[model samples]
Target: MNPETIRRRRWYILGVLTFSLLVVVLDNTILNVALKTIADPQEGLGATQSQLEWAINSYTLVFAGLLFTFGVIGDRLGRKRVLVAGMVMFGLASLLSAYSQSPAQLIGARALMGLGGAAIMPQTLSIITNVFEPQERGRAIGIWSGAVGLAIGIGPITGGLLLAHFWWGSVFLINVPVIVVGAVLIALLVPESRNPDPGRLDPVGVLLSIVGLVTLSYGIIQGGERGAWLEPGVLGPIAAGLAVLALFARHEARSDHPAFDVRLFRDPRLSAAVAAIALCFFAAAGMFFFAGFYLQSVRGLSAFQSGAMLLPFAVAQILFSTRSAAMVHRFGAKAVCATGLLLVAAALASYPVLGIGTGTPLWVLGAVFFVQGAGMANVMPPATESVMSALPREKAGAGSALNNTARQVAVAMGVAVLGSVLASIYRGELAERLAALPPGARTVAAESIEGAHAVAERLGAAGQGLIGPANAAFTEAMRTAAGAAAVIAFLGALVVLKWMPGRTAHREPERAERAERAERGTGREKARGRRAASRERTRV
Candidate 1:
């Protein structure tokens, strides 16, 4: 497409991109509400807890693993081509997931969806970077970030509604229509773009990165699932993954045609922004994981009700994210990001105050969610702009991949680390109470709040006594985890404040104006010299 056409239809193109992104992100969270249903022996597939975890982790591992590879592929081939192909793959995968005969089939299908998601994600951001001018990119990115928040907030609610009306598979099936519509709009409106000078393929680098990231993600997921980081099952893969990643970095640094340039991280703008994204997500994802349990198990709210309660968060995200560009324009990225992180920290810190009781008003939790959402709204757009701006437009795919990979890795780490903390604290608090129960019941009661609740229901009168202590222990654990997350978010704020550039939005115009003035002054001086030379010639 021509530049004029692209400019004219840019907003439309953004809409299509956001729609496509919504499905991918929505899928990430949508499965949460369906996990209970999918575990039922009669109503759905009888998936074990471990199988359910794999249903989620399989997707995550594949998505994180392939992101960089697909990003490089998009740059080398064509972004539009890759995007359409990914959407098609995602649609087919969703269909397969919906119709899967068993848990194993669903896991495999979800992995295929991840493969498509990786292909779709980087291309969207790169295309936006290429389409919008520097002046408008921040606003575009803010909107894109808002869509992500929207998807996350709605995913569970959508899943709950689908499961209520249809089946557990309906959550996966819902993506098909949306993908079809997106594919049509994408074909019609989105233009193809690629690197003019994409370097030669680095097969070794790609292979190393895939192995490193997948192994690392597997280790993290295993740690979370088992709640044991030091076990050989967890520690071994993590160590090996780190070693492989180190080798990958070394190879990239040495390669003549590196797939991902390790050198790009030298820029503080890119590096600091990437750090901020990773840290904030690390903090937030943990909070989200525990909050779901708190809402459902502790408070006795249904999945649909819990999902509805989070609407405030989505509202706050949409409102602030759309306006964050203006905030950045005024206060600058550094101020905005630091302030945002501070808000997130404050929100996280407030969780403990809600306490362990059902008496704690739900509205207070909603308010905290709103604040957290607003804080995140302010952070993402500025950080994303910084990442994209640090790279040449043609390298936007790599930059996008880097930003996303940091987030995915951090999310996995957050869930693992905070989950372990929660488990340890809860087990300690409830150990004496659990010992009073039968051996089989003791193990079940000690596992998780949900498990304790299930055992309570089964015991009838005997289980009634177990409920209060389980609630208390889980609440205490949640509070401690939230406090830890707050500290992490505060650290992110400090990092942004120290390293990210301040007030560059204002300074950039001043620098440009000064350059223009200098050019004009030079032109006038030459004009005067030419006039004087002409006068001298006439005199002669």
Candidate 2:
């Protein structure tokens, strides 16, 4: 497409990009509400807890593993081509998942969906960077980021509504129509862009990255499932993954045509922005993981109610994200990010207080969600803009990949670490109560709050005693996890305050204006001298 034509349709193109992103983001949150139904043997797939975990982990592993590789490929190939192909693959995988007869089938289909998602994600951000002017990029990105918040809030509610009327497959089936429409709009409105000087492929770096990320993600997922990290299954893979990633970094630094440019980290803007994103997501993802259990298991709310409670969060995102660019313009990225992280810390800190008892008002929890969402809305746009601005437009795909990779890795680590903390604390608190039960029952009940509830149901009258202790133990675990998350968020605030640049609006533009004035003055002086010389020659 021509430049003017692309400019004229940029807003429409952005809408299409956001719609495409919704399919990927919406699927994960929607699946959360379907887990219980999917676990039912008669109603849905008779998947065990381990199988269910794999259904999620399989997708996460594949998505995180191939994200950067696909980003590089998008830069070399055409972004529009990759994006359309991804949407098609994702739609087909959704169909397969909807018709899946077994947990294994669903897991396999989800992996294919992940492959498609990896292709889709980086292209959206890169395309936005290419299409929007620098001055408008932040505003555009804020809208893009808000779409994520919208998806999070709506996914469970959508799943609940679908499941109420139809089968478990309805959740997956819902993605098809959206994907089809988005694909068509993308073809019509979105312009194709690629790096004109995309260098040769780095197959070796690509292999190392996939191996390292998949192994690391597996280790993290395994650690969360096992609720321990010291064992060989967890530690061995983590160690191997780290070593391979180190090698990948070394190779990329030396390669003539690197798959990912390691030297980008040298720019403080890029590095700090990446750290802010990683840390923010790390804390947020862990909190969200546990919040579901709290709302449903502890508070006795249904899936639909829990989903409705998140509307405050969604509202906050919609209200604040679109205006964050103005905040950044006034206060600067460093101020906005640090203040936002502080708000996130404050919200996380409230979790321990609000989660003290099952009787705690739901409104209080909703208020906390609002604060957290608002904080996140302020942080993402500025950080993302900073990351994109640090690199030339041609390298936007790589930059987008780096931003997303950091988030994905941090999410894995957060879930693993915080989940481990929750499990340990819960088991310790419930140990005495569990010991009174039969050996197998005690083991199962000690595994998780849900497992405890299952055991209690089986024991009937005798198991009624387990419910109170289980709820108390789980609440205590949640408090501890929230506290830890609060600390991480506070640390993120400190990191941004120290490293992110301060108040560039007043200084950089002023300097440019001064330079322009000086050049104009010099031009005028030269013109006067030329006129004087011409007059003197004519008089002679």
Candidate 3:
């Protein structure tokens, strides 16, 4: 009843939200390390390039595809109800993922997990919008955003440790207990909230959206892996995906109750927020995807070791997440976003040089990741704040969902694009280096390199001398790949800076109303905390 009691309860609510988010985010990153393990279980899953691609992209594809629809579902049904339902589904999917017998099976299970993720992911931000006040919302969202960074930050390390001790399935299994605890706490403490006049579900719009996203995602995913844009297999899905998206757009424009108001593009703040989500995640996902290879293939780190090496990134993000919010409030999202993107670009560019040797100095890699992490810290929270602040209270679910969808889509595309680039360069460079060798040596080299081996076997004593040059070539190629990706990300920052609305002198009534909802959210957060503490005490 009292403010003090409410404050205590607020933290408990954040705990549940954070825990749920951890499951979603951890799944996203943990798979980065587990990919090799899952693919090549005996000599490390020996997963083909295509299979590896699917392992990462399948979850993202499903996550991105269903985000908008589930967001609407949350609005129409209830955010809490949707989240609880999603958690149950996600837990079951995780179990399925653990038992996967093949890469195809794992990919299928991951897709199912994404389906649940689509339902679970948006609520975390929407709830902050639902509960926290405007002034406090910025800070609350910062903390919420930080939790995401933490999950990503720790994912590799945690996954590596689990993999080292158990099987690849352990990473998925870890989500089980966390989700169970989160579900109970969320049910008890978080209040049921939804749109007051939720719009009707637009099946036509949903169909279009699904078609467009699937097509678009399939194109990028396939093109990136195969290193050719015109491959019929790649182009077919992309073309169909685009055609379906175009139809979806037309339907949304005409529909009475569109799945989303496509007209929101008119709002610079919303547009910038959407673009920022796309670009930021594009860079972030690329870094995560490639860094795994750099650490494992190039640097010769174990899965656990590579995950540990990423600590600087996680630590920097957690340290600066709240600070990023303050900077956004002071300088505005556009300035903060621009600065962040520049830093990310710089970090990406640095990779080519820093990626060179097996014994790369820890401080050098750490510094680069720290800068990238700081940028990431800025980009994520500021972008979320921009979108949530741009919309009315009633539209938070849809808005948040849209923002998250962009991110999911970007992540999938980035990995496909950047991952493809990295793979191609690595393969081509390896091929060229092997070209000078004898027939048997070349065969051994190609097979060995394809399997992530740093050096070939048949060359023996003579080949040992060539490892330095080959490694250098591969690193240089990755550098080129990473740099190009960075340029695209920087361009994304520019789009945000030029497009988002300028900060006003005063907060609007809608902003104030949103702030009030945020306060109520804080109340619910407190309620959840009290219940969690009580449970702890009872257990004691």
Candidate number with greatest TM-score: 2
For model 1, the run of ten residues with the poorest summed lDDT:
504-513
Judged by lDDT, which candidate is best? 1
Q: How do the predictions measure up, each by TM-score?
A: 0.89, 0.90, 0.87
Encode model 1's per-residue lDDT on 185-224: one tens digit a residue. 9999999999887657788987887788767766765665
Which whole-number lDDT from 0 to 100 does residue 219 have in model 3?
Answer: 76
lDDT of each: 0.84, 0.83, 0.78
Report the error of model 3 at residue 242, Å: 2.7
Please, what are the lDDT tens digits per residue for candidate 3 over residues 1-540?
344554567766776887888899998788887765664537455566567777778888778767777878898899999999999999999999988888788889988999999999888778778777676778888898889888888999999999889988898998899889989988988777888898777777766776677677767766755656788998898888888888888887788787756887787787887888798788778768767766776677799998898888899889989787788767777888888888888888887656645667867887887888888888888888888877888888878888888888788888777776765666576666667777755543443233434234344676675566556655766687778878877898889778865454224544667888899999999999999999999999
1-540 in candidate 2: lDDT tens per residue? 899999999999999999999999899878877776786667888665456656765676567666777887888889999999999999999999999999999999998998888899999999999999776788898899889877877887888788878999999999999999999999889999998877677889878977887677667656655667799998999999899999999999999877677788898878888899889888887677667667877788776777677788788889988998888888888999888889988998886856566778888888898999888888888888788877888888888888877776676567656766787788888989988999998877776777788789889998999999999998898888888998998999998988888877323643565788899999999999999999999999
At residue 501, what lDDT does model 3 achieve?
56
**Least lDDT summed over 10 consecutive residues: which range in candidate 3?**
446-455
1 against 3, candidate with superior lDDT: 1
- Score candidate 3 by TM-score against the native: 0.87
